[model samples]
Target: MKKLYIFVLVLLSWNLQGQGLPGLGAGTTPNNKPILHGKSWVAITGKPLGASAGATIFNQGGNAVDAACAMIAATSTMWDVLSWGGETQALIYNPHTKKVIAINALGYAPTGATVDFYKSQGMDYPPQYGPLAATTPGTPGGIMTMLAEYGTMSLEQILKPSMDLAKGYPLEAQTANAMEAQKARIKQWPYSKKIFLPHLGEEREAPEVGEIFVQEDLYETLSKLVEAEKNALAEGKSRKEAIYAAYDRFYKGDIAKEIVRGTREQGGLFTESDLANWKVKIEEPLHVNYKGIDVYKLQEWTQGPALLQSLNILENFDLKSMGYNSANYIHTLYQAMSLAFADRDFYYGDPAFVDSPMEGLLSKEYAKERAKLIKEINDPKIGPGDPYPFQGGTNPYSDILNQNKEALASLPADQLNSSLDPAFIEAFQSGTTSVETADAEGWVVSVTPSGGWIPAVVAGNTGVGLSQRMQSFVLDENLNPYNLPEPGKRPRVTLTPSLALKDGKPMLAFAVQGGDSQDQNLLQLFLNMVEFGMDVQEATEAANINSYQMQSSFGNHEVRPGAIVLRKDTPAWVNKELVDRGYQIELWNKTSGPLNAIWFDWKHGSFWGGSSDYGDDYGIAW
Candidate 1:
């Protein structure tokens, strides 16, 4: 009997240590929502309707890829801070190929979007709204491509939920209020005014909460896509070819014509050739092995590699020993993030346009060298390091690096120490939404889709919103030479989706929104699970620290050196320790995130889905 008791106690201790439940040394609160467990499938996204769309697809005998596409379509149609005109970036873990791939559906700058043109217009950066700020649409192409390549469902079946929604759905209070708040901007676009404001002359022009918001134009546009697919299928085209037929219709056929005409009518720079030529790229994703797990991210075009770099640096420390959310752990993470983001600000851009030295930047040796620079106190003046040497190449932009350092050094002391500007915070935490889906069939997808949020300019009668992603570009080469506002060049964006594998099997699929803070929140979420052993739910809803040390990807591209955001419930001792370390701390009731994740519980052969408490993020599991 004593032996039996000892055996049970040992088993309990192991489970607690491995799971990191409450009171098991993991600094996480009781999850606001319980973890969703599923043996067959799970769908989680930014909105309930979006999750339901994915669940509907799963119920109809679809894989994770199909469900994810459905969720993307549904969320885009619902205007969940994104629309069909926005860009999509996804990381898909294919169960058959046993490999992860990246979907690069980011739109490039349209015709006449050169830095010289913006300079001639007396603007330092692209306009923030309206036609002048739009990029060529990419979401339609992205959804079609993913569906054709890995999905096992017809385009009609996959898009039906969203099509039904485009006709009309009960408007949520959050989206309704957002439209009302930006009604003036929506009114500026004739097509948007026609759809968004039902009672223009009244106190509330936007639709009321729970009102059946009808979008006839959007419904018609979606119908065109389905019609194209149906026509191709009737003509004896294969399933993949039929999907491509829909893709071509959106990118190169009548739909493209309407989009270009509508954009031009609103003073936008889109041309017929621009729409016809833009295509989605399916490429091998980048990965770095930390410990025994392989972590994957999209290429240099996004802020993804920053997370990998942080992992490489943090791998050098014993994070589990440091305790979760401890002052030392937080400082280490901040320093590592600052170092990685410093490199991102200077080196990350479209690989087609710039040699970003990614091979060297992700090297463990390079991370070790960068990690050595982290001191006890915060270093607000940290600048990008020369990664060329690590790659066995000479730094071509050495002078630019020095200039950037000098410019940062020249900033006023007060500006560096001041609290985060409201404008800056708003832009830094700008728009986006995430979709995470998994199935028993072994397919998993993580997507971060954004642009064309509220206040977007709807393109004429097409009912498609124009992407405001052009504002991510910098007009001056000094800011980011590789990401200059050149026509046909893709902008370096903050959208990122993450996947990880352990023992050559899917371990976690996760993503989040919040523009520049995407990777910051993602990094913490990852560490919370892997290092601290918190379950998917606790890790996602757990409080995280946000560092404003890197340059913002939106608005004026400003940076707030040494600024840190902590949860209001953070211990006072922790705050004192950080302030003593030369940090400017702000305590918010909530840190920025609505992170969604699916943890593949290989031991139990099930999936654990987590949708953070913030926002309307929801999930379904069975």
Candidate 2:
């Protein structure tokens, strides 16, 4: 009788709140992982070893910037879907400046990477793999720049973790399996075959799980960088100067010469000048104030602004009143995202090369205008809006828009559908890894570093994998005039890192690892916390909807209009409503995440880190 009475009282409490589960205020929530508590610092990333690197830095008296650099190096060395030669995109919140800054380390197209060059080869877009797709390396410059500008540690101290990993580390199952799966492609590159396939003639050419995976060439390259920094420091150069000394060696010294020679050997288009001219830019990030919280993201060069635009449009709706994951709420979020992503697909690109109407695109009035287009159903034919008029300029691409509409109208019905094949799914969900770090001193960092996955083209004896980001560029202007392939132009990429501030202090730092689905998942994660009242952990683990309306930024750039993915646990009635509303529903066991986030518990003066249990994501707080 006592147990029955207690259960009845609990049920009554939930009924009184008018929701299925008590969210943020609840004593507990359903989760596979507990919220990490930290008083001094927290480090979270795609792998356990990566987080360990950050923790090591933190323990060595290094601040968040130094720790973040160490984790980036460690992960890059570990080949966690990235390499030393891949590009890096980051958002760092500096405690001293009380500002969030963007790091643009994206590699650019080489000298001969012209549209005509690709067209001469009978290709509409750049090839998805191999030497033809390589770009000027950017990750090395990015790390050195950040360390010199904001970090307190020396280059040697920051790079020690990666150097150790480069010598040898027990290979994990997933990476080993990936290498084995793509061994044929890996064997195509002589240098890659020499390093990755230790057992060439055996049944398994790639290293097995628990085997010591070594990269002697990469270790030597790292040692050379440290030697440069040490030589400069010994000569009485300042810490910043010493770091730049290492940077110079990588870009203009022996390292650069070797990279150029090796790349040319693989039929790549790299020149010494391409590597020497590349520099990392530390610039102001773009942000929007949503319901009193400021959300920051990288600029037009990345697809980040789309999330800001989606937030601006969503502000017009009363989300909480619609109930979490309800048909109405899902439909509203999907429509807003569709509107924003349509613009992203057509307009977002390298701002240095194109005059993207960002001032108007991010305008609240423009969002209000876009919001008015949202109806009770999804719009498969959704296209970019005219933001030029909002910014008081005339539309220069009006004729281009007309031609796009005509092209869409001419497409066959079957071709418009989503391909469920393994290959297509692989392209659609092309992966990256995220890094999130925070400390008691108020420094915060979020990074989405990617490019070199498995089967990468290793540049001769350097053991460094070249970036395959060139495939993101379109050869034809009609597809995206702003993103056409050209020499020295950075390809518009999917890498984005998010930071939110409230009351002039850090509120959240979050990022995810899906290709095109990154911002889509991030948008929902933000909403789940602010609107639905879920705590950071709940928000990170929440099942979110995914729309396949936007063109992919990877292989073939396919778009599957009206298709949406829902979690298998979605209510039948809600699923039925969505199908009736014209959505081609696809049930997924997990809709979108692997999201990693950190929330500032101001009231408690501590950090609450959330690492979703879906993937290899891990977090360590102390």
Candidate with maximal TM-score = 2
Q: Please give, for residues 241-333, the per-residue lDDT of candidate 1 as tens digits.
A: 999999999888888898888888878999989988888999888999988999999999999999999999898999998887789988999
Candidate 2's residue-wise lDDT over 293-404, tens digit each?
9999999889999999999999999998999889999999999999999999999899888999999999999999999999888778788988998899987898998889
Name the lDDT value of residue 22 in candidate 2.
57
Once fitted onto the true fold, the runs of candidate 1 whose alpha carbons sit more than 4 angstroms away are 1-30, 410-412
Worst 10 contiguous positions by lDDT, candidate 1: 18-27
**Steric overlap count per candidate:** 0, 0
RMSD of 1: 3.5
- After the best TM-score superposition of candidate 2, give how far the Cα of residue 390 lies from its true spot, in angstroms: 0.6
Error of 2 at 337 (Å): 0.9
